[model samples]
Target: MTEIVGRLAPSPTGALHVGHARSFLLAWWHARSRGGRVVLRIEDLDRERVKPGATDLVLRDLEWLGLDWDGPMLRQSEDEEPLRAAVAELLERGSVYPCFCTRREIALSAPHVTDGEVRYPGTCRGRFASAADGERELGRAPGLRLAVEPGELALEDGFVGPFTSDVEREVGDFQVQRRDGALAYQLAVVVHDARQGVTEVLRGRDLLSSSARQWLLQEHLGLPHPTWYHVPVVVDEGGARLAKRRGDATLVELRERRVDPRALVAWVARSSGVNAPDRIGARDALEGFRLDAVPKEDVVFGARERAALG
Candidate 1:
C-alpha cells in the first residue's frame, strides 16, 4: 500500500484564526488517524505580505493545540531553487509561455473568476520567446502563464463529491509567475506538493477551483496526483469567510482569556459536524476520524460563539 502523507501549510501572512484552527485540526486528525505522517510546511513565499516573526507564533498555536507532526518544519521560501526549476521545466514542456500583459491591461479583457482573480486571455502567450524577451518587447518584465487544455477537468473531492471546471472557458491560461518575478500560488503549490510527496491534500473547500489547475500541472510534469479533501470553510455571522485580521476569531485572543486547548479542539469538532466529548485532545479527536463527518457547506459562526470561541 502507498504511504499517506499530509501537510499543515500555514502561511504566516496573517494572524492564525479559528477558521485556520478548524482546518488544521481536521488535517491533523485525518493524517494521524491512518498512521500517516503530517508534514509541517510554512508557506511564506509572498515576502511582501508575510509578517515579521509570524511563523514562531503559528508554531506556538499549533503546539498549544497538541498536534504532533513528523520531521522538521519545511519553509517554502527555502526551496526556491526547486520551484524555479519546476518553472523552467514547464517553459520547456510547451505548457507555459511568457505573458507581458499588466494587471490593468489583463483586467480590461480577462474574465473575473469565482476567486475574484482575473484569468489571462492569452494576449502575450505566443508573442515572446521568453520572459526576458517579453521585457525587450514591452519594456517591462512579463509574467509567465500556463496554456491549459480544453474540456472539463473533473475530480472527486473527498467532501464535495465530483467537482468539474472547464479549463479553457472557465479558467484560461493562468499565471505561474508574476511580473514582479514572484511565483504564483497555483504553480508554487503544485510544485511543492509534488516534490514533497504529498499524498493527501486536506484543506478548505474554497480552494476547490484550484484543484483543476494543479491537476493539470501534475499531468504536464508527469508527477503523482494526490487525493483531495476540500472540507467546508468557516464563516462569520455575516456569512463572510473568517479572517485572522478580524481578531475576535483568533486563537491568540482566545488564549489570552485562558481558553482550554482541548475545549477549543472539542468546539472545532462540533463545528465541523463531528460528534466528540466535551474535552478532547488532538489524538482523541482522531479516534474515529472520517471525512464524511465534516459538513459539506460552510459553518456559520454566530455572534455569541465568535465573541469567545466557547
Candidate 2:
C-alpha cells in the first residue's frame, strides 16, 4: 500500500447508472483522501455485450461528475496477449485444467443452490489427465479451471471488518477461462490489478466472493495482495441489486431529464452516511469522506430516488 493506487473498473457493456457512479466515487475519494491516485480501467472483455460507444459515454459521464484519474485509461481488451500468457503459465503449473462440463451439466449437479449461483462440484477437476488428454476428449473446447487447496483465506476489509472464507468448499476449482477462450473475470482482474500496481480494490459487496478466488490466484502467481473494501450494493424497491443488464436507470437517462450531477452525488453522500451540503463535487464531497462512515447494508432505490433522478 506504499503508493496507495486505486482503480474504477467499469465494464462498457451498457450506460452506467447511479449505483455505478456511487461505487466509482467512493474509489476516487478513497485514493484522493490519502493524496494518492485513481486509475480508470475499461473492462470491455465481454465483446458481445459491449456497446459501440459505451466506453466514450462512460468517460464523458465520469468527467461530467468531476472525477479525475492519474493517467491514461486502461482497457481489458488490450491485455489479451498477457492473459494468454497467464493462462499458459497456469496450465504449466498443474493448478489449472480443462473443465468439459456444460452449463446445464453443472447446474444439475448443484440443483439445491439458489441466488444465481452454479457452484462447480469439481466434476471435471481430474477428468482430464493432461492438456493433451483434454484436447483429445473434447468434442467442443473445454473451459479451464484452477484447482483449489483445502484452506481458509482471511483478509481484513476496510469497510467490512475481518472477513474469512473457505474458497475450497464454498467454491471448488472455478473457471479460469471460459469454453469460448475468453478469460474469466476472476483471473483477468487479479492479473490486471497486479500489473497496474493497484494496492486497493473498492467495489460492490456482490463481488465479495471474488476476493477469496482472486486471493488464491494471487498467491499462486506470486503477486502482491491489495486491501479490499466491498461496499454495500444498490438495490431496487424489490431488494434485488441494480444491474446494467436489467436496464436500470442510467446516467444518460437521468441527464436527459435535467437531473444535475451534484444532486446525484448529494444523494449518494447522504445514502452512504457522508454528511454533505445540498450540492457538491467529488473533491468537495471528500470533506465528509470516511470509509468507516459508509453504511454496511445495501442502499435501496425506491420512489424517492426515482423522483430525484426523474
Candidate 3:
C-alpha cells in the first residue's frame, strides 16, 4: 500500500482567516483519517510581501485550532538551494530556458488573450545555449522558465472529478525563478511536494488553475504527481472570496469576538454543508466530516452563520 501524506502550507503574510481554517482542517482530517503524517510548511518565499511574526501567528492559529503536525515544520525560504538544483537539471535537459520578456511586453504582444495574466511569449527559448558558466549563475538575475510543450495536461481530482487544461494555450511558459532572483511558487511547491513524499494534495479550488503548471513541472522533473483534492472556497457576504488581506472573517477577529475553536470548526463544517453547526467535540466533527459531502457550490459566510456557532 502507498503511503498517504498531506501538508498544510500557509503563507506568513497575515493571520489565518476562516477560509484558511477550513482548508487546514480538511488537510488535517484527511491525513489523520488515513493514519498518515501531516506536515506544516511555511510558504514565505515571497520575501517582499511576507510579514514579520506572521509565521508565529500561523503556528499560534493552528495550535488554537488544536491541530498538531509531525516533525519540524518546513519553510520554503530554507529550501531554495534544492529548488535551484532542480531548475538546473531541467535546464540541462533543454526543458527550461531563460525568459527576459517583461510583463508589459507580453501583454502588448498578445492583446487577444484575456486571461488577465501575461502568458510568457517564449522570448528567450532559442536565444541562449546552456553553458557551464550559466549553470553557475543560477541564483543571479534574469530568472529561468520551464518550456511547456503543446499538449493537454489531465489529472483525476479526488473531489472535483477529472480535469484537464492546455498549458501552452492557458499559462504559456511559466517561471521557475523570478526575474528578481526569487524561487517561483510553482517550482518550490513541485520540488517540496516531491521531496516530502506527499502522496496527496488537499487545497482550495482557487488553486485549480495552478495545478496544470505543477503537473507540467512534475512531469519534466521526473517526479511522481500526487492525487489532488480542491476543496470549495469560503466567500464573503458580497460573494467575493475571503482573503487574509481583507481582515474579514479572520481567525483573529473570531477569537476577539469570543468564538470557541471547536465551534469555529463546527461552523466551518456547517457552512460547507458537511455537518451541523450545533455539533460538539473534535471526534464527532471528524466522524461526520466527509469529503464527498462538501458542496461544489461556493459557500458565503454571513453574520447569521457566525451567530449559529456562537
Candidate 4:
C-alpha cells in the first residue's frame, strides 16, 4: 500500500488567523493520527500579494500550534522549470492555446457565471496560430488557456462525497498561464502536488470548486490524483467567511495578547467533536483524532469566541 501523505499549504498573503488554525490543526491531526506524513508547503508564487513578513508569521503560527512536518519546507517560487515544462507539454499536445482576450473583452463577450468569475467565451480559441502570432496580431502578449471540451466532470471528495461540475460550461477554457508570463494557480498546484508525491489533499471547503479543474490538469498531464478532503471553513457569527485582508481574529493579535495556543487548540478539538480539555496541545489532540468527527458545517469564530480565546 502507498503511504498516505498530507500537506499544510499556507499562502503568504496575510497573517494566520483562528480560521487558519482550525484548518491547519485538522490537517496536522488527520495526517499524524493515521501515521501519515505531513508536508509543509509555502505557496508564495503570487508575489504581488505576498506580505513581506507573512511567511515568518506563518511558520511561527504553525510552531505555536505544535504542527510539524516530515520534510524540508517547499517554497513554490524556488523553482519554475517544472511549471514551465508542464505548460510546454500542454502546448505541444495542443491541449492549450494562446488567449489574447482582455478582462474587459471577456466580460463584454461572456455572461457572469459566479460572483466575480466569468465563463470565458473562448474568444481567442484558435484565433492565433502561435503565441507570437497572437502578440503580433493583438499587439499584446497572450496568456495560455487549457482547451476544455464540453462535458460534465465528476469527482468524489473524501469529505464532500460525490461532486460534479461542467467545467466547459461554468468556466470555459481556464487560463494556465497569465498574460504577464506567470504560471496560473491551477497549473502550479497540480504540478507541485504530483512532483511532491502528495497522496491526500485536506484543505478548506471554500476551494472545493477548484478540485475539478485540478483533476482535469492531472488527467491531461498523466499525473495521479490525490484523495481530497475539503473540510468546512471558519466563518463569522453572521455566516460571513473570514478574510485575511480584514484581519479577522488573527493569531498574531491573539499571540500579542498572550493568549494560550492550547486554549485555541482545545476549542478546535471540541468544535470538531473531540472531547478535549480546556487547554490541549495539537499533538495531544491527535491520539484519537478522527476526520469523520469534524463538523460538516462552517465553524464560527465570532467576537465572543475571539474574546474567550484571547
Strongest candidate by TM-score: 4
Of the pair 2 and 4, which is ahead by TM-score?
4
Q: What TM-score should be assigned to candidate 1?
A: 0.94
| lDDT tens per residue, model 3, 179-292 | 777889898999998888888899999998889899889988999999999988888788888877778788877788888888987777675556555655444566667777
Give the alpha carbon lDDT tens digit for every residue of 59-170 in model 4: 9999999899988888899867999999999988889999988888888899767636899988888776777977887799888999998998878999889999888888
Q: lDDT by residue for model 1 over 1-310, one digit each (tens)?
A: 9898999999998779888888899898888888898988889999999999899889989998988788888789998888899889988888888787888887888666656867667787668666677677679877778897779876887767898888777768888888889998887887888777789999988888888988988898888889999988888888899876666477787788788888888888887666888778888878767767776788876677754445
Pairs of colliding residues, candidate 2: none
Instruction: Give the clashing pairs for model 1.
Output: none
Best by lDDT, which number?
4
C-alpha-based local distance difference test score of model 2: 0.85
Candidate 2: Cα lDDT at 49: 84
| Alpha-carbon deviation at 250 in model 2, angstroms | 1.1
Q: Which parts of model 4 have CA positions greater than 4 angstroms off?
A: none
Q: Could you arrange the candidates by lDDT from highest to lowest?
A: 4, 2, 1, 3
lDDT for 179 (candidate 2): 89
TM per candidate: 0.94, 0.94, 0.91, 0.98
RMSD of each: 1.8, 1.8, 2.9, 1.1
> Tens digits of per-residue lDDT for model 2 on 26-100?
999888888888887889888988999999999988987889998888899988777788889888888798888
Better of 1 and 3 by TM-score: 1
Task: Please give the TM-score that candidate 2 achieves against the real structure.
Answer: 0.94
